[model samples]
Target: MEITSKLLNSANAIIEAKIDAKSIENKLNDIAKITAKKVKIDGFRPGNVPVKIVLDRYKDDLLKDAKQELFKKAIDDGLKDIDKKTDEILGEPIFSKFDEKDGNIDAQIEISFRPAVDVSGYEEVIPEYSTPRVTKKEIEEKINELLKMIAPLEKIEKDVLESGDFAKFDFEGFVDGEAFEGGKAENYILEIGSKQFIPGFEDGMIGLKVGEEKDIKVKFPADYQAPNLADKDAVFKVKLHEIQAKNIAEKLDEETLKKLVPNEEDITIEKFEERIKTQIKEDKFQKLLNEDLKPKFVDAIVEKINFDLPNVIVEQEIDLQFRNAWDSFSKEDMEKFRADKDALTNKREEYRSDAQKSVKLTFIIDELAKVRKIEVSDNEILQTVYFEAYRYGIDPKKHLEDYKNQGILPAVKMALIEEKLFNDIFKKDKKEEKGE
Candidate 1:
């Protein structure tokens, strides 16, 4: 038996091993001896089968077990020679080469480990900013939105359709002097300014009275989804049926406040205002995290921090991303992939840069999590899963089981940790900026 190890990179290493014929025979005999004690052959009583008979009868199965044992032993011996620990290894070891020749086996296994990262001055990259504050006007606007949401739509006693009013009308569009498919509808409810139809179609309805018929001229945009109608002029024959508007209250009332926040007990105008204020504040904070601060922070860290990622993990990420986006591939591209194996590789290269960045961010977040002492326990994860399940009307246990079966529980936990870590960092930074 011979084993040697080589460092491929800081985060990856390879081990080459060769097992002689005598060593393979010894391993097979050792396994056979163990199997003989538990054997139940027809010609022999249980626990009384000869080792020679056991080796001959289950040669293939025994040889497989022997090879596995030898492989593990080789890894152990190689790790010892390289002064590396088992727990330091990351993911499964990939077998780069495994071949048997002349009753001897040669194997080369590649192993990876988490790269070392120095996140000492990571906070320097975080931009200084004032804490986001919600205003009274914003709170009032949110309250008005809630009122509009709960208000009932009532028929407006008016002759003409107007902007901001709901118009229920019948319309049939024509192209090149002929009616087209999906170009006719009866009693279609559209908000005048909603722009649900092609340009000039909704605007053409303005000032038109109930039972009034008019041919509204419009043109479909060049990039319209339907190529047949793209960049083409069309006339929609329209007849306004009715006009409706939400009967929202100008002032806050007890009934409306109760409707605005159904979960609140003993709701009042003042309490509802406070609730809306808090909600607006929280929403602003979330927007800051999601749209503004988080992206900037991630970009800064990824640019500032440098480390070599394990190649296996990067490949895994690329594969996962490709699988996730498989549905979005064009039919022709999918067919190409099916017809040619290399076509898949060519397509996967498009995601390589993004995958590398994603994998790098993952490791960076991992290191930052440790630096900040951020952790999500199993209970916290389960609680989150249960909350999500209830939100989506799914059974909690089944949701959790699906996550486990799909092998994404760790990814979910990491996401939670990353969110928590970012929130903590941003909050602390805000405090520091405010001289708190």
Candidate 2:
């Protein structure tokens, strides 16, 4: 075996190896001897099967195994030549060239590693912002919302249905002079301004008196989820039967307090108010972090830092971005790409700059997390996945299995690490700001 390697960059390299016919033959015989010692062939004693017979019986399988072994050996020798370890490689080693000519094999493998990123002075780019402050008015508003959540519905003596009032009604819809599926219901309770129905449907229900029958005309959106009903004009015959409203409490009582915080015992109105204020403050802070501070810091660091990203990782990112964008392309645009190959290439190229930036930031976050000694435990990741699954009404085990089968668990872990990394950075800044 002859092996040589060249470093493409700090994180990438190419290994070229050639295995001659003699080496191939020797490897096959060695594998045959091992198989013979383990096999119990017909008319052959245990651990005494002839090597020649074993090789001839399992010729194809033995040759395949021999080739795999030789390829691994070549890669191992090449890594040594390049002064790299097998554990340092990122993704699977890509075979750029593999050919068998004149009873000799020539192979070339491309390997990449996580690039070293310099996040020194990254703290300087952290955006300065005041901590979120919860006002008395905001806390009161949130309390009012909680009160509404547990409010009882009562029949109202209103003559007309107005916005924010609930209506009990019967409705049947027709499109193009014909009734449609999923368009008819009896005694449906709907809030007048909920916008639960299609566009203009809720607004059309307003200003109707009890026992009134009217036709509400609505057109489905052009991009509606139901293709058959999309962009179609429909008329719903609605008969208002009753009007109702929530009888919200003007004051928070002990019973209502228990309902608001169901698990807590010995809780008082003042403590509940404090809880609401804390929640509002936390929500405001998260919004500021995610929407403003995080984006600004990420953009500044991505623009300020300079490093050569692994080509393989950038290309993988570009492919992912391109595939995701392809799902949203119009039929006409997709057809053009299918007709012209260059159009597809150009479309993919559009995402390359973004992909490079994304991959670069990923590495930066990884290195920064290491520098900060930030780590996400497997249990923490599982808890997050389970929480998300329950939130979306999916089975947690199945969701986790799907992520693993799709090879996205690492991506999930990376996302969590990035979140933790940035949060740590900002929290330290906050501590410093407060002289903590």
- Counted clashes in each candidate structure: 0, 0
Quick one: how many clashes does candidate 1 have? Answer: 0
Which digits, one per residue and each the tens of the lDDT, describe model 1 over residues 1-436? 9999988878888999999989988999999999999989998988899998998899899999998999898988888877888898888888889899999988889888889988878989997766777688888888788788788888899978888999888989899899999999998888889888788988898999988999999989999999999999999899888999999999778877777778878878887787787677667777888898899998999999998888778878889899999999899999999999898889888899999899899999998999899999999999998999999999999999999999979988998999899888887433543563
175, model 2: CA deviation in Å? 5.1
Span of ten consecutive residues with least summed lDDT in model 2: 427-436
Q: Write the per-residue lDDT of candidate 2 for residues 83-192, one digit (tens) a residue.
A: 88989888777788989998799999888887878889987898987767778899989999989989988889998889999999999999999999999999898988
Full-model lDDT for every candidate: 0.87, 0.89
Error of 1 at 403 (Å): 0.9
Clashing pairs in 1: none
lDDT of candidate model 2 versus the reference: 0.89
Instruction: Output the number of the lDDT-best candidate.
Output: 2
TM-score of each: 0.76, 0.85
